[model samples]
Target chain A: MDIFLTLFINGLSEGALIFLVSSGLAIILGLMGVVNFAHGALFVWGGYAYVWIYQMTNSFILGILAAMLIVFILGIIFEKFFVSRLYGNAPAQILITLGLNIVFIEIIRLIWGNTPIAIKKPDFISGTTIINGVTISHYRILLIIIGISVLIIVNYILKNSKTGMVIRAGVQRSDMVQALGINIRLYFTIVFAAGAALAGLGGALYAPLAGNVISTAGANNQILAFIAIVIGGLGNFSGTAKASFLLGLMNAFVAWFIPSFAVVTNVLVMAIVLAFKPEGLFSEGRKSILRLAVKK
Target chain B: MKSLREHIQRDFSKNVIIALSVLLIALLIFPKFSSYTMLNLLTRIFVISVFAMSYDILRGYMGFINLGHAVYFGGGAYVAGILYNKLGTTIPVFILSIAVVVLYSVICALVMGKLSFKKGTSVFAAAMLTLALAEVVRNIAESWRDVTNGTDGLIFKVPSILSNRIFFYYFSLIFLIVMFIILRKFILSPTGRVIIAIRENEQRAEFLGFRIENYKLIAILVSGVSAGLAGLVFGTFNRFANTELLSITYSTNALLYTLIGGTGTLYGGIVGSIVVNVFQNMLLNLRSIHPIFERWLIFLGILYIAVILFMPKGIVGTLRHFIENRKVKSDNEKSSKTEKAPGE
Candidate 1:
């Protein structure tokens, strides 16, 4: 029972981080039709900023907030400078984003010198809490709460906000949105920046969870985010959240029972998902979308 | 005489002659310019260029960016490495190894293709799947150390026939040239035209009665076969195969080469491969001269960005544009001279 409980919490915490990173990716892909491979770089930059700030100021909240703000600014700059030029061409966008990713990853390595930095939970949340004969770290439980809170806030904005409405309309048809006197190009820029900020937030939060921040981890997280987005359905926020949770649980369970299977399990799941629903679990309307596109 | 000249002009006879001459000269003189070590390095580059060509068949012709292509190439290397260790050095074993790798690649392709059949999975999704699968394969290769020789990487005595670095370089060059010929024939063939059409518009091609999936599958298979051949050559040349060869870097390198060479032209793949390899070699060699130049990844990233922004059409495409422009200019000049009126 303890083992199961521990696994569940661990998985949930990991899933939360995955959800934070992937939601940004899912939203950008769904609404703007831009596959930002540099999302991973944002995550990496966020972590590095947090660590740098924390080392300088020694205040966790300030460090994290500063990091998030930096990422937000960087995201906006990136959209304006780089992503703006690659609005419609996916292959070119992918190449540019990949190039940006390499530059960011290398910069991190150059600055940090390839050494893993130690990341600790703030002193206030440093202790463990025992409940129902199961011991859970307080920071981990905090992670779950934080994840839920962010999800609610984001979902609320996505569903009810005026900008969210614009995003939905743009997703339906970029040209039609422009026809309606809305500048979708501007919306796409804001969306990319927002996505970067969210990814930054996820990276900042994940620092303590993983106990270290490293350069290559962004690539690893990027892969995980991609897998999550694909499984959950490429533009669906809810689907990504659910898929992240399921994958997290799956990894935790596999690790406990058969540790070797933990890595392979993700690939096996992807293969199965690809076989069963190539459009993904939530891509119900893409067929019609494709048909409409073809007619045009 | 005019009709004969026109026929010769339309046939690409001159272009073929120029390309072959350049290739022949490079193959013969490259060894003399560089030492044994450099010869070996160039040979590896040639093999990898062939691998990039494999990727080009899928990415350029079939319009499918397969992220998992290293599986076949790496599989062949491992197969050959294992075979060389267990069974004595025999040419037949190399052939069998190639077959085994091709079979493995085909099975993997069928599975990946079936899963991604809906609107043919997005480039990002395919890349993610392949990256994940490569990691899985890497883990398997690591854990199954008994067979893979684990982190040490499987190494064997160099094959007697290819013991001389120059001999191996020449052999690989021949293999690359032959593969290029095959690829040229494929791209020029009716089937190749259909593949190109699918890349332009899959639904339209399907409406035009082409079996889109079947063609994609065949393209993938041919690509796998080429990768397998490259892998066999790589294993023989390096005398070892490691999990690194099956990494995301390998896939990325191939992708980068295709992008650099100009995917629209057959020779672009070869040019891209050579360019990147030469650049890398120079960077590594000059590390002592400029310590900061050790950051090769940064340079490569900048290069990728530059290529994407300025040379979107790639090297061959740019060259073709210039050549066509010159021809047009000459034709205009000839026409102007023939005209008697000043307005003309």
Candidate 2:
């Protein structure tokens, strides 16, 4: 019973991490209609920047703020210079983003070397707490809190904020939005920057849990985040949330019950999702013309 | 009797001759000037270019962004490696391996297509599904220790297919040429036109009474077969097969080649492959000059950004655009001259 409780919390936290990283990707993909493969690299950039700042100032909050800002600027620059031209070209967008991802990862290797860097959790979030006879790690609880809080904040921004409304409008009809005298390209750039900031935030939050920030880990997680979006339905926030939790919990429980099955769980979940609900659990409206590009 | 300039402008034969002349010169000096170090680089480029061409069948021709494309390539590698190990087979195993991969991909495509045939699950969702499925396959290969040899990977003595370096180079060159011929023929065929049609408008194609799903399945199968062939060749050259070969990164590389070369063009695959290889080689060499340049991957990323933003049509596409513009200018000039000659 204790083991079950522990795994459940563990799964939720893992899901939260997945959510944090993928939510940014979902929003960026939704509004921009551009697939940013470099989003993972952005996440890595945030984590690495956080590490550098942490070393410089020894203030975790300052490190996170600086990291998020730096990555956000980089993201905006990426969109302005590169992603703008790839608006209608998925293949080129994918290729360019992938190359950027590699570049970001390699840059980290160059700056920090191959050694994995660890970020110490704040004393407040450090250690474990006994909850209902199951000892839960405090930092994981903090991560969950932070993830949920951000989700709420993002939801609020998308729902009530004017810019978010513009994003929704852009996602519906980019040309129409542009015709409305609003610069859809500007919206895309902003959304991409915001998404990058969110990804950086997620990475900063995740640093403690993962214990180390390895250059390749961000790319690996980015691929996993892609899986989450696929299973959750790309461009659907609620779907991404549910899928992340499902994936996280499944991974946690499976790892606990059958260690060998842990890695396979993600693929199995994706296969099941693809087999049963290829449109994802919360997919709504018509498929994009980009999909029509596929013969099927 | 037109002058050389007028005749050249009037006929496509002149352009073809010019292009072929450039190609012949490059190919002739390429092997001679390239030493062992450069040959190795060239060989790697050829391998990737072939891989990219395989991807172009689906991505460039059929307009499907299959994120799980490495599955076909990786499947070919594993199957060929295993068969070679068990039967001590050579090229025959490669053929069998590709056949198996095609069968596997066809089945997978059929299933995936059926589920995601709806309008909403078109682009990112479909590609994501394939990626997820490939990851699952990778995990299975990693876990299936008995057959795949687990994460430790499979290593074997280099088979005597083409022991000498020159022979191997020549063998790859011939294979590439033959494959290019086959691909060109396929692209010019009626079925190929239908594939392109599907890319332009699926609803229109469906309305025209075409079996869209069947076409997609077939295109995917062909792509899988080609990827398998590339993978088999790669395995033979490397003398090993690992999970990394079946990764998303490999798929991304192929996608890069097709994009940078320009989609929908006959020689886009070749051009894109060459560009990526040359760029990569240059980056690797740069690493020796400045250790900090080891992070050339970042430059690659930035380069991709530049390409997407500025060169959406890619190198070949840009060239074609220039040629077409010149043709238009010449036609306008001729029309103006004809107008001036009122008596004629």
Top model number, lDDT: 1
- Writing each residue's lDDT as its tens digit, candidate 2 over B271-307 gives 8888877887788888878886666666666665566
lDDT of 1 by residue, B58-111 (tens): 877876666667777777788888887888677777767767777877776676
| Model 2 chain A, TM-score vs. native | 0.92
Error of 2 at B127 (Å): 1.7
DockQ (CA atoms), all models:
0.66, 0.55
* Stretches of model 2 off by over 4 angstroms after superposition: A85-95, A169-188, A283-296, B1-34, B89-119, B149-153, B342-344
| Reference-based lDDT, residue A95, model 1 | 74
> What DockQ does predicted model 1 obtain?
0.66
lDDT of 1: 0.80
Reproduced native contacts, each prediction: 0.74, 0.81
Best by DockQ: 1
Model 2 chain B worst lDDT window (10 residues): B1-10
